[model samples]
Target chain A: MNFIYDPVPWVINWLTQLLLGWGLPINLVNTLLYLVGAVLICLGAMLFTTMLIWAERKIGGRFQDRLGPNRVGPWGIFQSIADMLKIFTKEYINPVGIDKIPFNLAPILAVAAVLAIWAVIPFSETVFGANINVALLFIIAIGGLGEMAIILAGFGSNNKYALLGAFRAVAQLISYEVPMVIVLLIPVMFSGSMGLNEIVQAQKIPFIIYAPVACVIFFICSIAENGRAPFDLIEADSELVAGYNIEYSGLKFGMFFVADFLHAFTSAIVFTTIFLGGWQGPGVEQMPVLGGAYMLIKTLVVYFLMLAIRFTLPRFRIDQMMALNWKILTPLALVTLLVTALVDKSIPHEMTLVRIGALVIVNVLLWLLADRMITAYRKRNPIQVVTGKARPLARPEILPVVEKEAAQ
Target chain B: MTGMQILFLITSAVVLFSSIMSVTAKRMIHSALWFVLALLGVAVVFAMLEASFFAVVQVLVYVGAIAILIIFATMLTRRALEDKGDQFNRATLVTLVIVSIIFAGLVVSLKSWAPLQNLTSPLSAEQLNVGVLGLALTAPDGFTLPFEVTSILLLAALIGAIYVAYERKEKKK
Candidate 1:
């Protein structure tokens, strides 16, 4: 609509005009523009990633009641820049006995995986990389590349600890992916299209308001996917001693580090686009910069919440992580998807308010019930908070069947 | 040749090369990785055919799930990680001949079918009806029987996997 206001498309148009003016063929010009667009998107994502790392650290420090990165440039805005410089100077160590090819390939592929997802991300009304119809599926496929990177990093290192980390990555990532995919289906169903732009446009009321359970499931699963704290068992610093990237050092290690931070931030943006009314704030269409601004704010809000969760919650035992995914989140997501789809189908599309209210009520009730049940269970079977050990029963009552078996 | 035709040839070459490498890689894990490459190449071919849905699904299911599972299985097996054993057995030559015969027969069969050999019919992507596809999958009087049966089959497989993995505890009297 407001084509003149949209910077990205405007730039593309201007660039194409300039190239055509220079006597370049139309087909060649189109291809050149495509390459230029891809390069711009990749560079933009990488540049944004530096800020995300700085913001994450700054926000983290504030949350933890400490000043972070104050020594660098003003408020440490240049902290990531400094870190980037340091990483470049660091030696790229190839550990003895490590597979050279996969070892080298892993980190680059990891960063590439994150960069590739930008292809389908709808930044504003007129700005996107590919505008793929099956953006969600495209995301899931790209996720495989990330997991493959972890596997390669772990295996190529030839370290048992790294191998264990890789195993955890596969287990946790794949398990969490199931619930994430299921919850993702709600947005697709609501939008009636798999395209991210369509999903964003479909949000008359944000999907989060309509189905908070899916959003929560998506957030939790996404946290696991990113291997952030609580679900950070894959690279549990306390346990695995840097996990899969233990053997990696210097710039290669930095790539993995950057990829991890970028992935979490990218997912936050994805969350914003899908569940929040991303760039849906007033004057966004008329002013494309405003759309980008709205997008950033929404992403930062989610990113802040994610950091709040990461710093607060303790890491999950691998068993607990699996149990949470398979036993609780997967079933919950499936039921939510089914119920919402059924309830949604019966309602007329124009009655969005009613549909949203119905779904919200259902979700809120479930949340309350789950909370109460958890609290009840906690009270009935109290555990020592300090030791994290279960309290013994006051009465030593045994099952008769067990007693009979013991006697036999 | 057209750019698309050149792209298609490159994709096919990758697929063929990777499939051969998948069977030939000494380490089982390496073989699995090669298999992943083959699957990805096939997915690219699907994309070339303008079937974005299947291309995405192929990568999601085959590369993401199956290839990983294969690698995971190999890791679980003894010495499969750095396996140095010969990938082929004593009957390699006989088996190779048999496989080659089958491949030639398939090529002959495909060439005989003019309708199947024609490549221009699906040049452009059809305006896909995802709703109809979804309905056909789950709706009665469609593919519901096979869909329901597949669910049951998956449930059976799940139970079988769990049963295999389960360690025996105390016996019931």
Candidate 2:
């Protein structure tokens, strides 16, 4: 079976033995290995973020059916790096009438929250940065902090547009977080654990095969939670200019940009773990270190698939977005949770077929129920104006005349 | 000192400094910021205690949610940033004296206490990943009650937050 081993440790061990021949302690060698791992992960996350930015633009373009960022490097690979350099050297404008303290501190907090979530994630069984018991909860909790930073950035800017965008972003974030948490409960229920590593290990048959409804809910909520396309109403360029980051420029903007991409990447990896059978592939079990390689490849595949969806889907309106969560996703997640609980508790753990059948029944029921709710909602609240005793619809041009009449 | 002891001292110092500054800061926002630092220090202490989940939740809820909420409330309720507030009064002196007494009492008590005996050995990667934690949370006789209770608590918090933050829609229609 293929197993993952952190190469740094093996290298360090060899080096330590060689150094012990020259009289050095093993503890120092171990510490050095840890430091190296930390540095590598940090640099790796940064590089990954940079690459994702380029990948997103290119993928987004192809979905829009056009070429994107082709000039910076071969296939626009270096585009994000070039953009980073430009941002770093750009003029740092501290606009007047802004709260200087919170204004400056917001970006740092934003990036810090994103990076913090990465610490507990098990990239591989052997390569977890810190395999905390509550890895899942920690990821969610730390991820939530980014909203506060955005809100602070908006309010501290003293710009009216920025404040409006900030509040909207906060509303969007806090509202969607509920369904996201509820959806995450599915894996936790099925696996009967909250730990991320536990969740991954529970996917022997893949939770997606059992809790497909929850998988769909989790994926959609994740997109909205991360503020990506379609659900990216928080940072809607056409509507809110640049949303919360409108007033920010230079490296401050860079930090927000990088943080946003990192959030997306992390979300992608997380979805892979919960729904897509993380790190498990055919024939990958037999090779050493290739297990981790397979896991990474799977994560990247999930990431690219997310990018594909981003490019392909049209952005939902804020009202439509919330309706999808509340009316559609939330109810579906509830059913999935109920079914998983029932299957785990009632059916024999050995009876895979029965469990699978029950799960399928639950998902099918949810889909039909969702369709019914939509149709019923449509019937109850028709788009066309009803005739009985309704106030006359105001004409756009005549509204000014009516206002003048009121004043008179 | 052992590594854990040094870490405990550092984190405690940070928590103490931040708590003091949180009350004493001149600006309201500064006080809120200091409170975030203090809460984060508490999270680190939780991590040191091997309660990783609690540590993450502490940061997620307190630093991420409550602190931001405080800053938002301060900004919304106040006008332009104002002058420094009084740092200390007679009540503060009394509180400080009581705090020091409690601290000294705790220190004296801890001097005679034995270190906690380790029960479980350090878990292997395979065991740590899904085995032990999974068995604990499930398995009928394990932590199912605690798990469900936490969910209930989370639900209560969510509903309470929504109710507290709710505003009535304007009656224009």
Candidate 3:
């Protein structure tokens, strides 16, 4: 293999030889390499957040017709860096009457949960952390950790508002996860594997082509999962006072902030990997490193779409959000999964184009049917308009008597 | 000790410590969190044993869903936040004696188990594929009956839960 095209194996070989030359045991060397790889991925993700924050803010500003952080640096590129510096130097406040241990642990767990997801995502061929078989499940499981972090933050802070926010966040997360997991099954069913790398490899034609409904639902659910705007009831400032992280300040707050931004980008990466045929484009077969570029491009497209949605849409009401998840998205996702599975199973694998066409047609039909049902439901139960009669004005005749008495 | 054994020992320690903390923590939320840790330690043990499917499922189901439910329940129920009463109750002695007797019996039974005496070779990565597990669970001659039964049980519970939670409105005049 060309070293320029695929440097991971080459670098590993060089390191292995050097370590052996230094008389290190093989197992020890392997363990060291694993640690280095893990640390590198974590640091890389953390560092990537600087750029992500800058991009999100700049894009958000443009969407809102304003210039965001223009004075900090060129295009305000260094603004996140300045913000990071400030956060680093800020006081770490431990609120009085707080549960000390979980309070301290929550932010770290928040960041760690997001970082743990990076381990299973295959960036490119031969360039990833562990290629575990149950990567998709691992992602969901890590999401559970994120939920735990919010719970811990809320419970530990000893603030009612914080607890309320955490409760709402968890409720939103857990509710949305049902549809998310259901739609996730479509891709796994299509690819016949749960391993992300294997899924990517199996996508000769992207799974999105086969299952667009699932893709849309997955995107919506992922946004809800990340607790971004349109679904950002987690930190609805108008009500809950910054949600679960209200009591957190300084770097602890910063950690939660970083996790939020990273999670958005990570979800995009995941969407790319599963649906957009990650790292699969022309010339990728010859130059595996080119796959990384392909992956980045696809991820950016999805990430931009997410940002656009975030900046444009207003947040959902808590009841509306729950209704969407259970009444609409969950049922729709189940039908999609069922239809896709049956169709895919019945059709022969050799008839790829036919299968794709059939699945797409079915999906469009399903979407229309759901739309029609929603419209009918709305018509059947029109919003009630309560217009009570205006109360009669209470004119006081005693004011004239008081004026006459004053004159006398 | 080999690395694997050392890792196993560390995992066991974590599991034991967390389990103890889960039962002994004064605050209910802290106890729930400790229980989650103990579940995670069990997941790690599953991973160490090369049952990646089981490990991931354990984390997804036990730590993710069940533990979260427990915590939520603890939080929502009035006066469930903290235990102000004495740790040991009047029946502690009797409970301890019965627990020890059961533990001793378990130890003896486990020691006498033939499978424990002869260690089987670990499965290869191919043999341990999740597809294999799926097949085993679904195949007619395998665990199809038990799997179907479990799912049916879950569906029943779900329906029962919804029934319990549902409220009937009084008729309008």
Candidate 4:
């Protein structure tokens, strides 16, 4: 087991023994060591986010054929640091008539929720934060905090536009989450364990190879949750004027932006952990530090995929987003979950190749069916026309034009 | 008090206080926010009890779904937009009386249970984990009856919601 070879737990064990050897109290030593570990994880995530901001902008810039930010430092690698300095010095804005408590609380709450999700993510075999038995549920629960932040920010701002934007974004969020959670059940059923480490260990075969449909559904829904282009209606800058966080300014706005960027990468990391074989690579078990490197590389690849999707797609109309969730993704995810569960049940646990093959066939069929159904549904009832209706040009409406001209 | 007991007391206090404030807050939205806080405190209390599954479930179902529902409903009602308004009627005494009666009954029932006399040791993590919870939920002769019934109830609720939202088309002809 990689757990046996992983050095993090061994290091912690060694530290505790060192403390005990030095005559420090046992419970206190254990508690202090845990605190340090948790703090280090938080720092790690934050530090990663700092670089991620630069990397994403660079990727986005290249995609758009721009120079990106080459001014600050070499290739603008220090752009995030410079941006942080600037945002730190900018004046904060409160704008009178806002609800004080929720207004102030929203930004921090948004960042904190994303931070909390890291508690369960297994970086390597023995390098998890909480590793709780119900880590999957814990992630879902922690997600509520982000939703609450959006609602509070919109309502607390006392702006009509903000409130309307909040309504739209929250609706989008809650609707998409239904499929996201349902899709999550596929992997949980496959592993038969909810602890993230257990899920990783169970994936001797990466889950994406087994349940591609669920992975695709999860990816789409997570993109909505992360709120980037296409699903980025929350900050649809052109129409809604920055949506729910419109009233926020300066560091407060910066906090929300940081959280947004963090969440995108976090979702990517989670996708790596769940769908790809996390930290599972050649020489990882022999040299456990390689596991961390493997995990990082996989996460960056998935995150780059997210960035590509974000930069490529056009924004979705609100109604189309809702229809996609309700009419398509939700039903597809539910069917996938059911089929996967059945496959898991019928196969002996030892028959790995046979089980994967069964799941893949079921997923392919369901994918084809879902695609056909969507195309057929669209043929029957296309999207409602948004622009003003056009009268028949040859009119038959020429009579109305002549009558209006005569009256004038 | 021990550290665990102290943590328990703090979380309980948070739940109790936030719940009272949730009922008393003037704005409906603010009240909903307070209700969320109270739910989170209850989740913390569950964690303190070493019921991590229940703790997360409480947050997932209540804080995520139910509280969001309440807020959405409040947003739907135009009256909930106002910060200052008459939120309740003059029959405060009647509600107080009804509430006290229920509280007293609960106290009396709890006092009668012998197992409640002393706190038992916390269950091992494995015993209280998702495996046990899953078995307890779906195993035959266990909670399977209630489990299946709940699923049916949820389906009924979904159908009812769809029915309510169905719009009839009046033919232009």
Model 1 gets an lDDT of: 0.86
Checking candidate 4 for backbone clashes, the offending pairs are none
Give the 10-residue window scoring lowest on summed lDDT in candidate 3 chain A. A391-400
How well is each residue in A91-178 modelled by candidate 1, as lDDT tens digits? 8888888988789999998999998888898887777777777999899889988998999899899898999988888888999999
Q: Name the runs in model 2 displaced over 4 angstroms.
A: A1-9, A15-23, A97-101, A237-239, A382-408, B80-173
Reference interface contacts recovered per candidate = 0.54, 0.77, 0.69, 0.80
lDDT of 4 by residue, A1-408 (tens): 333566687788888889999998888897899899889988988888889999999999998889888998899999999998899999888878999998999999999999999889988766778878888878878888788888889988989889888888888888988999999988898888888899898887799999999999999999999888889888877788879999998899988989999999999889999999898888866777777888999998999999999888898988788889999999999999888888879999788889878888998999999999899999999877778777667444466877768766
Q: Which stretches of candidate 1 lie above 4 Å from their native place? A: A1-4, A372-408, B122-126, B138-142, B166-173
- Against the native chain B, what TM-score does each candidate's chain B reach? 0.86, 0.61, 0.91, 0.91
TM-score to true structure, per model: 0.91, 0.81, 0.94, 0.93
**Candidate 4 segments whose C-alpha is farther than 4 A from its true place:** A1-7, A383-408, B171-173
How many clashing pairs does model 2 include?
4
Per-residue lDDT for B10-44 in model 1, tens only? 99999999999989888888888888889999999
What overall lDDT, based on C-alpha atoms, would model 2 receive against the true structure? 0.78
Cα deviation in Å at residue A3, candidate 1? Answer: 7.2
Where is model 2 chain B poorest over a 10-residue stretch in terms of lDDT?
Answer: B116-125
Q: Number of clashes in model 1?
A: 0
Error of 3 at A112 (Å): 0.7
